[model samples]
Target chain A: MPINYYIILSLTLFVIGIVGVLTRRNTIIVFMCIEIMLNAVNLLLVAFSKMHHINQVATNPTAGTEAQLFVFFIMVVAAAEVSVGLAIIVMLFRNTHSIDVNFLNRLKH
Target chain B: MTIIQILFWLLSALVLLSAIMVVINRHPVYSVIWLIITFFGISGHYILLNAQFLAVVNIIVYAGAIMVLFLFVIMLMNLNKDMEPQKSKWLKLVGAIACGCLLLVLIAALKDIDINNQIAETNTGNIGLIENLGTVLFTKYVIPFEISSILFLSAMIGAVVIGKKD
Candidate 1:
C-alpha cells in the first residue's frame, strides 16, 4: 500500500522489459517488451497520482487527474506507435522473410 | 496486512511472473498470452489505486485492443518456434547483467525516499470519474488531445503506405 511498494514493483517490471528488449531476437517480441515498459510507467504514474490526490485533497482537487490524463495520452501514442511499428515490421518480414531485428542492419546497402 | 495489501501483493507477483514468462517463452504465441496476463495484473493494480476508469481503460486498450493487434500480427506472420532464430548466449548474458545493474542502481537511488504509510482506498471519489477526466481533458489538456489525434492520423497513413505491397 505504501508508495515505495508500487515504485519497486513497477521498477522491477521495467527492468524485465529492458532485458526482453535487449535479449530478444524477434522484432515483434521487442515491441511487446516496449509495451511492457510503457505499462510499468503507467502503473507508477497512477500510484503517484493517487498518493498526491490523497495528500492534497483539500488544497487541489484535480492535482492527481493530470497523471491519469497523461496515461491516456500515453495509451493513444502507444496505439499509434504500434500501428506504424507493426506495419514496418511486416514490411521487413515480407522482404527478408525474417523478423529478426539484427537482420535489419543489412538494409543499409 | 489488510485485504487491499494482500490483493496488491498477489497482483504484483502475477505481473512479475507473467512478464518473465513473456520474455523467456520459446514460442511467440505463448509470449503474447503471458503479456496479456501481465496487462491484466497491471489493470488490477490500477483498480487497487482507486483509479477505476484507468483500470477499465487499461483492460480495453492494452488487453483488448492492443493485444489483439499483436496476436493478429503474430498469426499473420505464420511464426513458429523453430523459425525463431536464437540470439547468442553472450548477448543474453550481457543483457541480464545490464538489466541487473540498472535495477540495482534504481533500487539504491530510491532507498532514501521515505514514503509514509498512506494506503490507497477503493473509493477516492470524483477525481478519477469519467466526468472529471473529460472536463479536465477537453478544457485544460485540449491541445495535447488534438495533437494526439493528428499523431494517430499520420500513423494510420504511414501504416497503409508501408504495409501496401510493392
Candidate 2:
C-alpha cells in the first residue's frame, strides 16, 4: 500500500484520540485516549519502517529492524506506564471517591 | 484491486471505527472493550505489513494484558455505569473543532510530500521475523534492552509504593 494511506489512517486515529482527551472528563478515558494516540504512532512507525526496508533491501537487508525494535520497546514502556498510572488512579479514587480530572484542580492550592 | 489492498482498507476501517467508539462510548467498560477491538485491528494491520512479531506482541501486551488490567480497575472501582459527568456542550464543540483543524492542517501539510509514492512492503520482509530481530536486539540494542528491564523494576517498585495503604 502507498505510505500516504497509512499516514492518513494513523492521523485520523490520532485526531480521534486528541478529541477524546480534550472532551472527556474521566481521567481513565483520557488515559485510554493517550494509549490510542500511542498505538497510532506505532502503526505509522511500522509502515515507515516497511517502506524504508523495501527501498534499502538491496543494500541493507535489515534496514528496518531498528524501527520494529523501537516499537517493541515502546510497548514495554507503555506497559510499565499503564501499571504505574493505574496505581496512581486507584489511589486517587480511594482518597477522593471520584475519578474526574476536574477533581484534581485542588492541587493548584 | 489486490487482496492486500482490500485487507488494508478493511483493517483501517476497523481500527478507526473502534477507536472512535472507544472515545464516545458512555460506559467505561465498553470503552475498554472498544479499545481492545482497536488494538486487534491494529495488530491485523501489523500482520498485513508482515511485522509478525510486533503483531503478536501487540495482541498479547495491549489487548490481553493491559486491557485486562484496565477492565479490572474499572470493575474494582464499580465504574460500570455511565456516571461520568458531561462536559459543557460548548467545551466539547470547541475540542472537536480544534482537533478537526489540527487534522486539516496536517493533511494539507503532508498531502504533497515527495515520499507519497513509496510503498511499504506487505506480506514480506524477514527483518520483522523473530530471528533477525533477536540477533539485533541482543547485539546492537542489548544495552537498551537491559535498561528497559531496570525501568520495569523501578516502575514496579513505584507502583507498589504509591499503591500501598498509608
Candidate 3:
C-alpha cells in the first residue's frame, strides 16, 4: 500500500466531513461530522507513523510512536469535547426546543 | 496485490460509504449507526497496519463509549423525528462547492509530498504494542497524559454545571 492510498482515503473522509459540517442543520449532526474529521486525521497520522517506522534504520528506532501518542491525546480531547458539546447541545434543546443551529443566533439578544 | 491490500481497499470503501451515509442520513440515530460502522472500518485498517493496540482502543473508546454517548443524547433529547429543518439550497450548494475546492487543494498539496520512497510493510517494531506504548506514555508523554486528566476533570464539571437546571 503506497502512502498515497492512505492520504487519499483520509482526504476523502475529511472532505465528506467538511460537507456535513457546512450543510447540516442539526447541531448533533454537525458535531458528529467533526468527529469524522478527527477520525480522518487519526487515520492519516497512523498511516504516516507506519511509514516512518518502516523507513527508520538508525534514528529513534521507535519513530512514529509519537504519532500514536498524539492520537491518544486526540482521543482524550475528543472525549472531553463530546461531554461538553453534548451538554451544551442538551441545554440548547432545553431552552429552544429545537437543535437547529440557526436558533443559536437568538442567543445574542 | 496481497490480502492486506485487498483488505485495505475493502475497509476504506466501507469507511467512506458509511461516513457518507452518516452525513446524508436525516435521523440522528441512523447517523450514529453509520458512524459506528465507520469506526469499525477504521479499526480494521488499524489492524491491517499492525496497530493492534490502537485497533482495540479505537473500538473501545470510539465505537463503544463515544457512540453510546451520542445515542444516549439523541434518545434523551427525543430528537427521533425528522425535525431538523433543511438548510437553504444556496447554503448546501455553497457547502458542496467549498468542500470540492478543499479536496482539490488537499490532493494537489499531497501530490508534492515525497512519501512514496518508503516501503510499506509489516516491519513496524514494538511501537504499536501495549508494553512499548505504555512505557513511552508513562515515561516521555507523562505530562501530556496528566494534562489530559485535568481536561477530563474540567469537562466533567462543565457538563454537570451546564446540565443542572437553572
Predicted model with the maximum lDDT: 2
Q: Between candidates 2 and 3, which one is better according to DockQ?
A: 2
Query: What stretches of model 3 exceed 4 Å from their correct place?
Result: A107-109, B122-124
Give the per-residue lDDT digits (tens) of candidate 3, residues A1-109.
7888888999999999999999999999999999999999999998889888878847777888898888988988998999899999999899889998887897589
| Candidate 1 structure quality by residue, lDDT tens digits, A1-108 | 678888899899999999999999999999999999999999888888888887888898777899899998999999999989999898988988999888789758
Model 3 iRMSD vs. native:
1.2
Candidate 2 chain B least-lDDT 10 residues: B75-84
Assess the local accuracy of residue A65 in candidate 3 as a C-alpha lDDT between 0 and 100. Answer: 88
Model 1, span B5-56: residue lDDT tens = 7888899899999999999998999999999999999988887777888889
For TM-score, candidate 2 versus 3, the one ahead is 2
Q: Tell me the lDDT of model 2 at A96.
A: 92
CAPRI grade, predicted model 1: medium
In model 3, which residue pairs have backbone atoms overlapping below 3 Å?
none
Q: For each candidate, what TM-score against the reference?
A: 0.95, 0.99, 0.95
Question: Model 3, range B1-166, lDDT digits (tens) per residue?
Answer: 8777788889989999999999989999999999999999999988888888888999999999999999999999988655889998998999999999999998999887777555555534677888878999999989989988999999999999999999
Candidate 1 residue B64 Cα shift, in angstroms, is 1.3
> Taking the tens digit of each residue's C-alpha lDDT, what string does model 2 give over B7-116?
99899989999999998888999899999999999999999999999999999999999999999899889984657888999999999999999999999999999998
lDDT digits (tens) for residues A1-109 of candidate 2 = 9999999999999999999999999999999999999999999999999999999999998899999999999999999999999999999999998999987888699
Point to the candidate with the largest DockQ: 2
